[model samples]
Target chain A: MKIAILGTGAVGTTIATKLIELGHQVMIGSRSNTNEKAIEFVNKFEKNASNGTFEEAATFGEIIFNCVKGEFAMTALKSAGKGLENKIIIDISIPTDTSKGAPLSLIPELCNTNSLGEEIQKAFPNTKVVKTLNTMWSTLMVVPTMLKEGDHTNFICGNDEEAKNTVKKLLHEIGWKEGSILDLGDITASRGTESLVLLWLRIWGTTIGTFSFKVVN
Target chain B: MKIAILGTGAVGTTIATKLIELGHQVMIGSRSNTNEKAIEFVNKFEKNASNGTFEEAATFGEIIFNCVKGEFAMTALKSAGKGLENKIIIDISIPTDTSKGAPLSLIPELCNTNSLGEEIQKAFPNTKVVKTLNTMWSTLMVVPTMLKEGDHTNFICGNDEEAKNTVKKLLHEIGWKEGSILDLGDITASRGTESLVLLWLRIWGTTIGTFSFKVVN
Candidate 1:
């Protein structure tokens, strides 16, 4: 499978490397095809890895992972241009505002009533937007078994059922248990998962190690 | 220990009943001393149980539990008046807006940056306000052992260390394991726990059974 990862940051590179290792053609996208970090990332992998502009990368893959920062998600997608049309976008972004000091808070306009996922879905009605893997650290996103043998929970929400199923298969391939992936209804449900980031930040402060949430009954 | 529960709602009654069973003098408060629910509640218990107006209840107990709806928490506290001075308020309320329909959303003004817990703390600067148990179902709040042998997690946050310690002791009496109670710093952290309600409501829609979150590493 061909995958497009939009961003040159830790999240984007980490996921791109993992996908490439799984034999998927992965492209790390940035504002420019000449981005040094994106170039460096591609250099780390021998084959099935490449660096390109957001538009070039989005145009290259069937599935696109919005690994950019939450605040920049829309802008990055827009830069990806017409390639996003009718494609499945796995949105793994949180609108975190670091200006609020330690233990970050979400962007006010996109915090509760509105969310980046809903916003992207509304903006790109032709695209299938599935929100997942935004609740934990980048390292845990690809390797769930690192903590509790992957028994912890992960949530995915979007308007398109097929898109969610595809994302679920991708998650399973990344080592997440079938039962661990929770499908949380529609795109609007992103508000809930996105809000969890605030709690996640606070919990991170206490234990500066890798951790995730498990739903217990 | 004398505990005041300022509301006749399910959460208030549930916690009050448990405290009374643990041999603590419990008072259930409502808008009026003649509230039918409050009277009926007191009738069910022979001793260590009483009902009164918000003011009477707050004055009767050394610690007060703000179990009232989040929208009216400040108003209820104001009605309780000077009795709240220097007392600890265990706020177990979420500013939920059910009008938005199923899987309730938080009130716009109180969702992200601000919270009812912080508002109550700000309103009564002299009082100690600790926010906890607002993230799960009412029954699970007191009897955590009902799920997974109480191995799940609960969070408490407040500006006062002594107040938090006092509340921690109370949580232990309620069957929460000492390690299960996570202290998440100041009362502002309530925004995180309170924001969790949005996610909790969605999760509830899926299982329709009793469940809670356990932070796993």
Candidate 2:
């Protein structure tokens, strides 16, 4: 499968590298055509991996992963332009402050009344926008078995059923079991999952580095 | 220990019962002086349990549990008057709609910007407010060992060390291990924990009723 990962940040690169390892053709997307991180990812991964501008990657893949920062997400998707139309777009960004010395508070403008996922879906009505994997670290996004007992309690939300199934297959490929990936209804549910960033950050500070949430029943 | 529970709702009753069972003198506080639920609790529990209005209960206990609905929390606390001063307030309320047939959306007014815990602290400047157990059901709050594997990963937050310690002891009395209860910085950190109500509610719908979050490291 041809996959496009927008943003050459840790999340994008980590996911791109993982997909490349799984024999998927992966493209690392960035603002600049010659983004150093994207170029470095291509150099490290070699075969089935490449780097390009957000538009080029978006146009190239059947599945597009929006891995950009929430602040820059809309603009990057705008750059991706018409390529996103009718494509399966998986969003994994949270609207939390990532700047130096800034408290990791969710940006009120994006996450308070609305979520980045909702905004993206509104921006590209033609795209099948599915929100998932933003609740955990990028490493955990691709490697669900890393934590103790490997809790597969991941979540997915989208308006389209087919799109959610497609993402679920991808999740299974990355070690998330069928019973583990919970479908959290429509895009509106992103409000809940996205808000999880706050708890995630808090737990990140309190516990050991490698961790994720497991719903104990 | 003398304990006051501010509210006759399920959460308030559940915690009040648990405390009474642990041999503490528990008071069930309500909006009205002759609240039937509180009166019923006193009659049912038989010993170490009483009923009163918010102010009466507040003045009676050394430690107060703010289990009132988030919407009416301030008003209830105001009715509690000066009795909250210097008392350890263990807050388990989330700012979400609780009315019948309500959509159960997190109240954006408090939870979006600040938390009910922080608001209570700010409202009664002399009180030591600790936030905990709002992320799960009232049954789970009192009985943390009910879930599968019984992975106790409860969290608490407050500005005062002594107050947090008091709440921590209460947690241990109710079966939560000392190591399981993490102190998440100061009262400001309540923002993250309070926001968890959204995900909690979503998961509540998707999974079986018996569930709580365990941070798998």
Candidate 3:
């Protein structure tokens, strides 16, 4: 499947490289010509990933990955334009308030249901918006199954079944265990998960080491 | 410290007996005419836990373990009455809508701002409200350290420092490892955690063999 990772940041770069490694065609989108850090990070994985503007990547791929920082998400999707009309966009956007400018103060914006992810979906209503991947730290997004102990849980939510199924196929192709993928239901369900990210960070930092969760029964 | 467990349900009985086994004075309160199930459950343990009415438990203990169902949390507190004033109420209520009769819905009554735990705090304004134990299943409430490999987290929120210390100490005695307890600050934070109980059910049920979480680095 053709996959365009929109936003060449840490998470964007990590996911693109992993998908490329799985022999899938992957493109990296950036508002600017290049993100030196994101470019350099991807170069380490291989030369297969091509970088371009949001429109170029959007038109080129069947699916889109929303990896832009929450603040620029709307602009990024708008740049993707009419190409997003029926595309499956995996929302990895977290409405983190980096406003005070400290990682510690970067709290989830779910204190309001009208969060940034909600704003992005509103912007591109034609897009089949699914929320996933934002729950894990950027470093853990690649083949997260490598970090799992058993039937772990990675949640996905969207209003479109076909879109969700496409994302699930990609997730499994890149190492998600089949039954472990929990379909949390509808794009709005992402609201709960987006808040869960903040709760996770409170524990992921400090004396405890960061780890992913697996819902084992 | 003398501990009082409100609502003689399975959760309350389990927590009281566990605390008593740890050598604390414990009382279990029930509105159901003192079921034999509670007494029998208590007798199997080495702890000396006595059963009584809400008022009796409140008058006897310095710290109260509030574990009534989400619907009756305030009623249970009110039944306990002025005795709860200025005392530490370790609230374990979540806005779980068992009214659909299913264990899954996050009823409107329980939410990010007005969670059942927070409601209990608002009702007994003088009572030091600490929200914990609502995030994990009732079964894992007793021995979390026995199940996992890392610093899995449990959150607590309250307005009082002394009460947090009291509950923190008790959590340790009940086999929660050091540094595993998190104080999210003030009674309102309880709103987030109390609701997390439903969100947490998915992961807790399968992993840690029944609602156990450990932090790993």
Candidate 4:
């Protein structure tokens, strides 16, 4: 599948490269006037991952990833244009404090609410927004890494079953097992589900530092 | 330490009884006219636990368990009056959706956004609010029957270290291990930390129906 990625940050670059290496075409969209930084980031993940402006990139691929920060999620999506309609929109952003020590940005950063992934769902009501990868570290974005026994529990949630199934297939292709991609129902669930990112952070803090969770019975 | 439980529901009753059985004094607080159903719920947990108005219950104990629905947390605290000051407050409530369903009466059956818990903290400004137990099922509110390796990770967050320590002791008294009780730090984390409750529900949906998460290295 041709994958068009918006916001070529660390996680985005990593995901795009994994897909590209798997023989899928990858196009990364960026607003950076001098997008050399984003280009370099993508190159680190996989050589030959393409980068372009929002419209050009979105028009270039079948699958689009909204991998911007939780704060810039809406703006990036809004700029993805109506071309995003009916496309598989992969959402991987968490609402965090962008303004930890400075004057608070109006963004979801420093936000303690239902949040950015949710806001993405609301803003692009037509796009099939599936929430995943927001719950793991950039290093383990593709393959589901087991940190313990009975651990196939990388989760996903979306109102559209077809969209969820598509993302789940990509997850499986990226190494998520059948049992690993646990879908927790529709987008309204994003309220509680998106917060899983925090659990990942806390877990990552203690672990030898792997973005993984193993569900032990 | 005497525990004054501010909200009397399925969860409030469970926690109140378990504490009493563990040899702590417990009081159940409901609105002015708590129905027989409410008293019966407490009776299921403890025969000795007393039922009183919110203020009476708050004034009756040393440590406070904010067990009400997240939506009415403030109103319950207001009813509790100055009783919330200088105490270790164990917050087992989440900011859940009340308006999407019935009124506050049906809140315990739902979940809230990070809004409601923060609201309670704001109302009881002097009270040291530590968010815990909100992440687990009321059945596990005490301790899990089947113990497994790497099985207890309690994420606690509050601005006051001493207050968090007090709640940790309560967790220990019930059945938590020393390393299992993790301090995630600060009330602001209440947003992401409490959001894990959603991830937990997904964890619950998979096999091994009843379980809790333990942060393992």
Best by TM-score: 1
lDDT of 2 by residue, B13-85 (tens): 8888888888999988888879887888799976899988898899999999999888888899999997787
Candidate 3 residue lDDT tens string, A1-217: 7888898777888888787888878778888657676466556765567777788788878999999987677788898887688888898987666665422322334432344555666777788888887777776666564564424567787878998898898887777777768776666566556656545654554344656655433
On a 0 to 100 scale, what is the lDDT of residue B142 in model 2? 86
Specify the highest-DockQ model's number.
1
Give each model a TM-score.
Answer: 0.98, 0.95, 0.73, 0.80
lDDT of 3 by residue, B94-212 (tens): 76766674336566645543567667777777888888887776767886654464246677777788989988988887877667787666676655565455446534333334544
Compared with the true structure, what per-residue lDDT tens digits does model 1 show for residues A63-85? Answer: 99999988888899999999898
- Model 1, span B1-217: residue lDDT tens: 9999999999999999999999999999999999999999999999999999999999998999999998888889999998898999999989987678655788888868888899889889999999999888899998898988899999989999999999999999988888899988998899999999878877877864788999997
Q: What is the DockQ of candidate 2?
A: 0.66
Report how far off residue B115 is in candidate 1 (Å).
1.0
Off by over 4 Å in 1: none
CA lDDT of each candidate? 0.91, 0.84, 0.70, 0.69
Check candidate 2 and list the clashing pairs.
none
Q: Which runs of model 2 end up more than 4 angstroms from their true locations?
A: A98-102, B97-103
lDDT of 4 by residue, B139-217 (tens): 6767654557436566777888888887887788888777767676666566555656556665565465766665444
Name the TM-score of candidate 2: 0.95
* Best first by lDDT, ranked: 1, 2, 3, 4
Name the lDDT value of residue A10 in candidate 3: 76
Query: Chain B TM-score of model 2, please?
Result: 0.94
Ranked by TM-score, top first: 1, 2, 4, 3
lDDT by residue for model 4 (A94-197), tens: 66556554222224432224456556777778778888766666766665554543254566787789989888888878877787566767665665556555
